[model samples]
Target: MTVNPLATPLSLPARPELTGGRPLGVLLLHGFSGSPASMKPWAHALAERGYAVEVPLLPGHGTRWQDLNKVAWTDWYAEADGALDRLRASTEAVVVGALSMGGSVALRLAEERGSDVAGLVLVNPFVSSTRTELKALPVLKRVVPSLKGVVNDIKKPGQDEVGYPRLPLRGLAAVLEMWQSVVPDLPKVTQPLLYFRSSVDHVIDPSSSPTVLGAVSSRDVEERILADSFHVATLDNDAPRIFEESAEFVARVTAS
Candidate 1:
């Protein structure tokens, strides 16, 4: 579980900023094996509109995938939880936005924080997988360190997510373990939610979106289907819609 300090150079740093204008803040989280880079553009989009934004680089991510193997789900969730605390300290209210596994963390935050979290915006979230192969992770991780890469599922040619090229089995198991614990508590996420699902996602299964939508207690839930993006829609063709619509959603939900 100890990380090599030399691996830090492989990933980018966390993004944090304070806009003196509004009391509203936005917390953005990246996906598993991914860094804050995935959420950077979205954070910028929100920041340009004068909202404070904090996009944290999760533990063991943004570096070598091997680093992720050293940390568990609690470590990752703790990073997001800490970010929420920091955001809440400086702003009147906070909204959370995430992509992929980040969405799972955001859901957990909303569930635990209650009225402290103003709203949620998620893109291509992953909760559980019906894939039989993944079920073997409980044992496979003991022998295999990693499998193939799951990053850069973008349709945009030549574009890359800069995430780990290899998927750490231990890390993947930690995420799935978190999913198992979070799924049943989905009903506690009563905050206003905006969920984006990609029609042709190769990474996440089709059932994830419906499972979340069906379980969450949020009466103010909206689902948007992305016709032209993959798992990393934030950096894909439909990115503009994601950015613009999320900004609008934040305004709508946080309006006075």
Candidate 2:
């Protein structure tokens, strides 16, 4: 059988739309080494429910992994922050949802934006890693260019996340930097939080969720365990739960 070209490791189109009904906007972020394809289903689910949604392709992402190494953590965060700004400008309130490293970026946005962000929905956010290799990232990033990839961690078959097949060391370093930067400010995220974690994940260490739950100052924080999914849970079996619960969370938080 012939393969679809878009299914290959190539840059995909960015997904962004403004649903003209609700004054509430949702900014959905995909994971590191991933494109908007991962978040597209969730974005559409929220949009159909009358919420404005923006799923931007992060800088240096959705393209070649080599390109990801050329950029820094700040670049990725800046892109997400800009998207949040545009969403906030059009809507009265904004809720940020992210997967993996995308969740780290969301927390950073919540910390910096303060009360501007209405709520947060995170799926297996990467905060810190216990990997011994990570300790050498600073030096390895300068010597090594890339390593084994950590993409397409979904358990569902015939599904594609359109992520890079190789992990760029510089990009990995940037992700580590983002984690370190966001960890300290976790307490600053006072917005309501909805965290979704897969029961079994090979990509991210399981310690991430507990660290977030313990650090965040949000009193309305809630956690849902994805019994049948992996790290990229957005494209897995429990996706509907994430989409529905996030929409409901946004409604409850943004209600005036």
Candidate 3:
């Protein structure tokens, strides 16, 4: 499959820093169907702060919806976990910044990797769905390979999320299954968390924030409201706020 240029992975070494002699690191992850394009701006911001940054294109994405359908949730997690390992190899500490499904994968990384993940910066993270249709995904996916498009939920005019034009049912089911494993291990996510939630999101269900905030054992959890964005908050009007605040969050947490 021919991947779009926007889908290319980003790997930047942190600039020389005197803070602790070793530069810190960050792993930014995009949402379902979406590619690294959604994360570039934010990753650049952190990289500018002398932090090593990586934005890896997830498996089954940036090509076609049919490709995503054949992927399992485990594949996404493995890629994220590997990126985290790579970042840790050079930096003194690490923070994970994620959007939508990437947030779900981030949670699992925190759970399994423990304190190696210094902190979390999540934007419009997706967890459980209240949609009644999802309950029938097992049967529904077998009947149909896809549904309408779930990409480009940004309210910013002329913005293209550059994700699959259609939603793959089998792929959707795979991500939802990840919630089962993550939710149960939420208590293991004790890292300081900076969560960005869109007040007017069209793609993510309202139930998502509550499920995560209610279970994470983090003692330094802060939830900020994105008043002018949607599910793809990284590409929305409130993107600047996410970039600025998340950088601060990473600096503060990694310093501690």
Candidate 4:
């Protein structure tokens, strides 16, 4: 139930070309209750490798969880859509890399936008929520908007940090709704998918494993388990490996 609104809006750099032979474009999305700050290193690495990267700050995020109560899943999706459009304006094809809930958005975008997206990199995405967790959210959202600042303590990507301490219950509700909304459409995702699963993650449901692999229509599916990381694999001990695999995936997608 930890969901704190982002305090101040954060701005992400847009459409900077990698000074090589027209490197492909990459769009990155951070997880719920997270911000672009978490994905900066990954984006910078891609940028260094001659790939243009766009990591947008999701709406109601990077500011505060209270604002998140007013925002819906659509708002977050639109942000990612905007980032993808930015990538499209500069490159021939776009690759999407998303962490946690961000992964769901990336998959949905690929499903909806089709050939516009080249591939997907998913890190601990939430396709489904456990029943008990779902039932408790509404009460938590109302009784405790900021759950004692626990939500704020999450790990950020570029910083040695955990987010706010309170869990923004209303913010989490929106995320749960988003998960339910997108689960059915997973079969529509036809692009290549690279899943970076965290062996130690306790947040996402165990059901995610077979469901994701079975539902995705992608012909090229690669699943890598992070042996030493938690839910935030992008910033954990296995981060370097995640970067390498993601870079390789982007290269393959661009070449094809």
Instruction: State the lDDT of candidate 1 residue by residue for 85-142, as single tens digits.
Output: 8878877778899999988999999999998899999998988777889888899999
Alpha-carbon runs more than 4 Å astray in model 4: 1-20, 148-162
Tell me the lDDT of candidate 4.
0.74
Give lDDT per model, in order: 0.84, 0.84, 0.89, 0.74
- Backbone clashes (count) for model 1: 0
Candidate 2 has a TM-score of 0.91
Q: Which residue pairs clash in candidate 2? A: none
Higher-scoring candidate on lDDT, 2 or 3: 3
- TM-scores, all candidates, are 0.92, 0.91, 0.97, 0.86
Q: Which pairs of residues have clashing backbones in candidate 3? A: none
- Winning model by TM-score: 3
Q: What are the per-residue Cα lDDT tens digits for candidate 2 across 1-256?
A: 2222443222122223333335678898888888888888888888777777888778877668888898888898898888888887777788899999999999999999998899999999998877786888899889999998988898989778888999999988898888878999899999999999999999988889888999999999999999999999999989998889888898899887
Q: Model 3, 254: alpha-carbon shift in Å? A: 0.7
The Cα error of candidate 1 at residue 47, in Å, is 0.6
Expressed as tens digits, the lDDT of each residue in 1-256 for candidate 3 is 8888878889999874634566899999999989999999888877887889999889998888899999899999999999999999888899999999999999999999998999999888888889897889999999999988888998899877789989999999999899989998998899999999999888878888889999999999999999998889998899989989988888899884
Candidate 3 yields a Cα-based lDDT of 0.89
Model 4 agreement with the true structure over 111-133: per-residue lDDT tens digits: 88999999999888877755685
Q: Residue 245 error for model 1, in Å?
A: 0.4
